[model samples]
Target chain A: MASVNRPNKQQNHPLDDLIRKDRIPHIWCPGCGIGTIFASCLTAIKECVATGKNGFDLDKFVMVSGIGCSGRAAGYVKLDSFHTTHGRAIPFATGLKLANRDLNVIVFSGDGDLFAIGGNHFIHAARRNINITVICVNNLNYGMTGGQVAATTPYNAKTTTTPAGNAENPFSLPLLAYASGATYVARWTMLHTRDLTVSINEALSKKGFSFIEVLSPCPVNYGRRNKEKPLETLKLYQEKSIIKNGADPSELDIDMEKGIILGKFVDIDKPTHSEKYDKLYRIE
Target chain B: MTENTTESRVLTGEHFMTGDIACAEGALAAGCRFFGGYPITPATEIAEQISLRLPRVGGTFIQMEDEIAALTSVLGASWAGLKSMTATSGPGFSLMMEAIGLGLCTETPCVIVNVQRAGPSTGLPTQGAQADMMQARWGSHGDYEIIVLAPSSPQEIFYQTITAFNLSETFRLPVIIMTDEIVGHMSEKVIIPEAGKIETVNRLRPKGRKDRFKLFEPDPNGVALMPAAGDGYKIHVTGLTHDEKGYPVMTVEAQAEMMARLTGKIRNNIDRIIQTEELFLDDAEIVFISYGVSSRTCLEAMAMARSKGIRAGFLRLITIWPFPDDQIRALAKRVKALITVEINLGQIHREVKRCAEGKAPAYLVGHPGGTVIPPERVLAMAEEVL
Candidate 1:
């Protein structure tokens, strides 16, 4: 099996081997937090597998992504990956996990890719309790598409499409996921690097639909339009973020002014899609 | 678990069954273990039959959220090392177009059953139509070749469904079984052969070390072997145009290389893929060309014309796409007229006309398609020459 843990000190960075570094100096802007969030995910996977905390099989690990800035993550990862169509990653990954139980399938995508166009698939997969990990980067706007207002864009935030102000209310991702029956759900900002990484590891280790929503910085598009600089937003997250584990998901809707509620909101045991399916169809 | 004799899963002996039920039995006989589908009007019985029979045969059936997800899940199951399929009608088949293109681009092998019904947009739900014939050929938004089979009766559909699976596995493409509502819902006697008697083809599995397996590198036959998710090959499958390594190359050369193989595999093997049935064309003055439910009407019309001392012949298409143009060209030279009978306005009739290409006076007997084209209409066309 291919090992994902070995540190290559000569490469200037430990994750250089896990990354398609030739495609480096990536398309993401300098202040964009996609790189950091991606790095944290790699670290989480490496730690979970290498430390033997989980008997994860690297060979059977597959990463799937939809079209967007974040969709490019699949092409960079040096494992079995699928860069599927726009807004269809969840359904595709759901199929992959259900088709083969041994595969540790993970869907890595963006806010517009998930909550906007892919909302139906998201609700359905969670409803079925599929065993797959979903990491959504909420940059508050469609950064790659010239900063259109997204489903998670806070009310009154300015975007290219919503220059006056976003009149639409944002969806509380945790509440939506929890209500849809996700077995594990959490929220964290990109500034909480270590905590976000740990949450990714936890979601990976869980046996049902697990979702982690990461608040990321999109300086070039989102930040410039919204008047919040990248570094300033990180500092704001540090000051205003409150860790409240086991809080009611309904109460954790992100409020840019009051504060951001961050922590694991839901984690409960449930027989996953394949578990119940296999048990019912057991060929004895 | 019981040892996979690959025998008892097959249902044998003769029985009275609908086209939908025979279709399901054909898939089970072909060693298909995964089915993902939605419930649509005429095609719903296919999902119903497969749902009940698949569990008994140790197979999996998933009723996805929608038709898009239905075909999408089947593609996923195919990559996970299962012979998978999905069934839908016109509206549902339209919803699956994007994934069909994805399946074509990725060269994923699976079967799709479109029990075609009337529709420009859900025109008639419970009735029959051959309107989707052209859509089945050029439905998805790209340039590529496809393999489609249209079965005329329940017995023929049983055999055609198995052949659809075999060809899909052999060529690494989605094979379409385009049976219409008339053939789909009608009851008839279908004889299923024993497992030992039936021949099924499985996809080529890569051998030697997993590290050496380049996922899209073709064999001499122009088809590459496949590796499942856990095969240690660690292949990357993307919908983007890709190179031989199965990685997105995003270059013109990569697309040309990929498209060349994708379109070439079936084209080069056209001699084997296109199947047709010719009846009494040896000394005929005019030929009536048809397929699916329409072909049955042509058979009756040909006999009616011959009884009137008119020399009329019938050419039935079993495989429509990668069309039997060569046969039509050959017959066009000898026949005085070539007439096509179809339920659709002029879907396959257009193909027949293009292939005939003025060598003969090409004509059509067509309808908007709520029911099968009657033999009386075909006989009327045949009487013109007599």
Candidate 2:
């Protein structure tokens, strides 16, 4: 389907044609990792197309996002995109996939948008194993609205909302997705651009609900308050990173100062929602 | 539009069905191929019927996680070039309010049926009420307009549901079928017309240069031709106030233009969207104005009024959101008083009063609802008003 539609020949840059050039430079602050994550996904798609084996159908591509700094990724994509309300990217993407089997819907959203208000939709979509790829940019705080403590915020972290300090424990997103029936689950940082892109490519090629959590930096708000510079934080991530595939997601919780598990944890096959539904209800 | 009365989905012959079943059949008859819904009492039968009937006709039926996802999926399916619908009760309807706003803002055509039971917070799960009438009009936040239809019986609901889809498609808005638990659960004979005989409306599609197409740029009539995704359109759909380029434009000027187009598309053609059934309203002194289940009781009340030598009339609102303002205004002048009968205490009655505007007194014959209004009680109100 994508081969029939002519690619944009006028633009000089390969990615310029794929992104809304008029909308750049984006609203993300300097040292923000959201842009890197966005570039990774775009590069990944381009690589998938070049390989012609990673299942990237350009015409069938759809980007859906909720409200946040990362949510702007949907508008940046040249494919059919939906910028839905806050905390609704999963369900909205679910709608796109279920309505048209042809669409390869990718949900790009932030930690607060995906796990806080949109928690129910996230768990349910995973539980149903809806066929879609979800990319969660975990910034440890809500960066768009001036760094409020989110569901993924580290315990005892001082955010604007948590002036004294966060009392609640942060979520291990990979574990949440794995337990909720996601067929593929992985964790990577924005610093691991190549690996993250590969993970995205693999997830796009795979079936059922695939989730990739990208531990990203929001230095302007989260870092300045915590006294960790952007470079220092990236150094910490590089030092603490451990590549252990098939690690139990439940046992791999994040401790910023301590070692952090960073690798693909769960990957298996399962019949997706529409697959099982059609099997059971197909008519003569 | 007349042809053979034969199709796998639409049954031509008469059959006894509940309002829920009739609503589902009505959707299928209107060319709806996608059914995304969640189970809620008094409205679940609609989903169940669709789940059973849709698969046979090569249509899709997906029971979503919640009513929020149900309506969102319906919107998604509609944008994918399939007519779609979903059904829910009060609590679910509340859950769907946000999606409703998104649908209207994005100009996504879809249908939502709220088989209303008593509420404030699940006041009655199984009993019928017209409590959500006001919510149907003003439930979603923002200055926007919608088309709401009220069905009094299973047969009427069947027809009204079809009309709901037509108006939704034509205007590119989310149309609501505001039937209650009484009408939704009531079993009655419904006549299904032939497929070609049924009038179905689809959103206007883009023609001419695809490059010239602006996703949100409205034509002279204030509605842009909707282009489906994956048709090489690469359109951007958002809930935010946006420019004709479909880019978020958060300014007073941009908001005014965008919001105007979103609202004016419906308001400018309210006459085409509004439908009301006026019965024996001519040369009558006492008027009964109502909708949904309450409309049925109003008829019986009007009949009982004539038996008591009282001249009474009734105006049954089929279109609830456009509010049938002209009909109420016309009836207000010709009658001594207009008695508004509904299960909930005077929701639409306020509209009747505002429309009446001292021309006639608009009296409320209602209660805080858990059940349908009795004909005797409505008749007694008519007598008192007369």
After TM-score superposition, the amount by which residue A140's alpha carbon in candidate 2 deviates from its true location, in angstroms, is 0.9
Q: What are the per-residue Cα lDDT tens digits for candidate 1 across B1-386?
A: 12123236777787788898889889998988889889998999888877777766777788888888888878888888889999999999999998899899889999999998898788899999998988899999889999999999999989999999999999999999999899999999988887899999999988898766788888888899998877777778888888887778778888788889999998899998999999999999989999999998998888888998889999999999999988999999999998999998888888888988979888999998898777888889877754
Model 1: per-residue Cα lDDT at residue A12: 79
Model 1's chain B TM-score? 0.97
Index of the highest-DockQ prediction: 2
C-alpha DockQ of every model: 0.59, 0.61
Residue by residue across A1-284, what tens digits does model 2's lDDT show? 77768876665765786887777767889999998999899887777777877455787788899999999898888888899988888877777787788888899999999999899999999999999999999999999999999999889899999999999999999999999999999999999999999999989888899999999888999998888899988987799988888998888799866688999999999999988888988754
- After superposing the true interface residues, what Cα RMSD does each candidate give? 1.6, 1.2
Candidate 2's chain A scores what TM-score? 0.94
The alpha-carbon lDDT assigned to residue A9 of candidate 1 equals: 56
- lDDT per residue for candidate 1 within A200-277, as digits (tens), equals 999999989999999998988988987888888898789889999898998987886789999999999999987787
Model 1 native-contact share: 0.54
